[model samples]
Target: MRITTVETFVLSERQLLVRLGTDEGLAGWGDATLEHRPGTVAAAIRELSGYLIGEDPLPVTAHWQRLTRGGFYRGGPVLGSAVAGLDQALWDLRGKWFRAPIHQLLGGPCRDRVRLYTHAGGPPGQTAAPERARAVVESGYTLVKASIAGPVGFLDSAATIARFVEDLEALRQAIGAGADFGIDLHGRVSVRHARRLADAAAHTRPAFFEEPLRPEHSRLIGQLAASTSVPIATGERLFCREEFVPVLEGGVAIVQPDPAHAGGITEVFRIATLAESYDAQLAPHCPLGPVALAACVQLDLAVPNFYAQEHVIDLSSAGSSDLAILRDPETLVARSGYLDRPTGPGLGIEVDEDAVRAAHRPDLLVPAGNPSWNYPDGGFAEW
Candidate 1:
């Protein structure tokens, strides 16, 4: 079937959806949302649609190569996100045409159910960290993660390090030893702070220390990995396999590539395979909408090295906005901390077009950008 139209909708300030319609009437959906840059990604999608208008939608890989490499300057988060949405749409079309799920098209399932992890322990300095951890564990999540919230200085005092360690220990104790807890530095800490925090939290044994150092300081990941026993996990910021090479070689135990911003299913699956060769695991980073989570679930089922899945929304919650946009809210809900294999075609979840369109707000098409912060001395601080 030839491509007929490529449409993008800014469903919310944080969610962007893409729908690719074909002459044969089969349409595929994808999420290309780039936090704080929805407008830029939407424009990128429109620009890339020029090459896809009359092309066949079944040749997913070929289309991916051209959409990504066709441009002289390629592979940043915006371009990767644009191509990622289109790639997901192409794969969805291929799946529908072949009458199979995307995972089956990728050589079938590796596991019966995909394990998922959710964020807990609200912003740092909250006294309810343990309570939040207990709440998620009681809800049937065996794994949970929380970020080192708020601004962090380059050389913060011992009190800063102690608070993080105390928080992690509390989460670990709250969940009991049977469950696992992870800490996300969110690229907000320097190498020195990361080292100190890792050393102090080693007793708690976090599932992984995510993005301890920013992407720019990735070369030092191996050195950092050598210093701590904790597993080093990163890659929500790194866009492609080329960018992942150093981290993989640096002994990063888990690679968390976001399908939405890391070339969708096509590239994330490849990234999982690349990580597999290095004896690492794939725990895809997905903190966006339902379509993006569905896309990540497909990869989790297909890749043998799949470790766990990260999600911002509580899939089991009935009132979550993430589920409101779907035709079947239960499509991605986890049972016993795992999502059963989806039997439906494509990404396996149906997007409620009416809900999506209704949720679209023109004013929200352009995000106001992420929050910024400053140190006590007035120096800029990472948010």
Candidate 2:
């Protein structure tokens, strides 16, 4: 079917949906939701708009190349993300046309269920250590991840380091080995400070240490990995598989590709495959809306080198509505700690079109940095 029109709708649900119309009336959906950058991403989508009209919607690869390499200068969040959404819509349309889920097209499922993990909230200090850890374990999550500090600058203080380890030690004592624990350095620590946190948490045998240093310094992650037994996980900032090539080869034990940012299913499928070649695991970074999660699940189902997923509890009202729209969304039904792959067509999701259309560009729908986050010394921190 020939592509007729491509429309981008940024909804009040804090998600961006691209609707690609085909001549045969079969349209596909893809989520290109970028937080704190919706307007910019949407504008990029519009700028990459012309080539899609009248082309065959089924030629996703050709279309992707056209939108990506066909340009004067290619590759960045704006151009790359716009093509990601469009590529997803093309894949969705193809899947629906064949009446199969995305996994079947990728060579069928390697396993029945995909494992997942959730973020367990805690205070800046150890004020609620036992309670928070108990809440996570009691809620039946087999694994929960934590960040020791809100913001950690280079060589902040020995007291800061001591407090973080002390709090984590307390949580580990309370939770024990019944559930696995991990930590996100949040790219706030310098190499030296990161080494310190890794040294302290190494004894606890945390699942993995994530983004110990900035991803741009990913070349050193392998060195950091050698310094500690814990695995290294990053790639939330990563946008494509080509970007992740050196990352996996860098000896990072895991590759975390965010479907929303990493070119949706098309590129993520490629990312997962490349990771498989290196014997690295894939734990997709998805802390966004359900459509994006559904897209992640579809990729997770088909990938052979699958790993646990990062999940987030709904923090806002619109986020709740986003999940409600999915046809077969997976919730935290951890059976000894594993989430099953979703079972629905076309990424296993069904969007609430009317709500999506109504809330086009909903308040707080646009992606902008959160300002409330701050370091202990009153400096701004990354959120």
Candidate 3:
């Protein structure tokens, strides 16, 4: 079928929308929204839509290159993310046309079910922190990822590291050796601080350490990786393959690509390929919404280098306003630390249009201070 129309939706400032309608009445959905730059991404998508509207929707690669190279100057969060939404929409349309799951279109499944990991186990708590971790373990997830520390910046106190170690060690003990624990540093610490932190945590033997240093300081991460046994992981901030080259060549144990932000399935597949060349694992950063998670699952299923996925299984308390419209409210059900392959067509999980409408925020979301730190100078700090 031929292309019909291309439209965008910005229910609120934090959401970016790109929908492609076809003559056969088939439409595909995509999200390229940045924190507070929904409008910017939307406008970028709108401009790029001109190149796609009259063309074949199935030519995802052609469209991708045109949008990316159509302009002399290219590749950044805004452009890469804009192209990502359209790429997702196109893949969805192609999947529908072929009447197959997105994975089949890629090459077919490599395994029976996709594996997932938990984001619980912070500090000791009967409340939202430690309580959540205990609950997930009780629910039967043996592989769990927990925030070992809150927000720590350059040259912080060693006591902070001690406190972090104490809390994490408790989590390790409470869960026992039956589970594997992954730690996230959130890139707030400097190299000096990361070296010490890595040394301290190495003794606990975490599954891995994620974003120990900020993305910009990535070059130094390799040095950190060399200094300690803790596996180094990063990739959330990187928007394309070019950005990932240095890190992969340098020796990262795992690479985290957000399908929603990293040019969707098309680019992430490439990122997965690139990571494998370096013997790095793919975890896929996905703390966003379901469509994004669904897209990630398709890629994860098709890739052989996958380690585990970061799933926000409990968004209810977070209100997960976007979740209200998910095609399968039960899309995320990690039994033994693995998210099963989606059985639906296209991205498999449907987008909640009504929920999308309801959750729309006219104002974009800004980066607020670290939620853990309520202090005057703004607690230690981590994203």
Whole-structure CA lDDT of model 3: 0.75
Ranking by TM-score: 1, 2, 3
lDDT of 2 by residue, 74-169 (tens): 766666667778888888887887888888888998888777677765766542255666676776666678776656667768887788877777
Residue 338's lDDT within candidate 2 is 58
How big is the positional error of residue 170 in model 2, measured in Å on the Cα after superposition? 2.8
Judged by lDDT against the true structure, how good is candidate 1?
Answer: 0.88
User: If the candidates were sorted by their lDDT against the true structure, best first, what order would they fall in?
Assistant: 1, 3, 2
Off by over 4 Å in 2: 12-14, 125-130, 313-322, 327-337, 362-368, 372-381
Q: Write down the lDDT of every candidate, Cα atoms only.
A: 0.88, 0.73, 0.75
In the range 41-75, model 1's lDDT, one tens digit per residue, is 99999999988999999889899988998888899
TM-score of each: 0.97, 0.89, 0.89
**Residue-wise lDDT of candidate 3 within 1-383, one digit each (tens)?**
77778777665444466678898888888767565577778778878878887777888888888888898888878888888888888898888888887998989887767767768744442111555666677776766777645456577687887777776777777677777778877777788988898788677788888888788887777788788888888998888899898888778899998877787889999999999999998988877556667778888888889888877745333244456667576655554556667777888867766666666654553323224553347554554
Clashes of each: 0, 5, 9
> Which pairs clash (backbone N, Cα, C closer than 3 Å) in model 1?
none
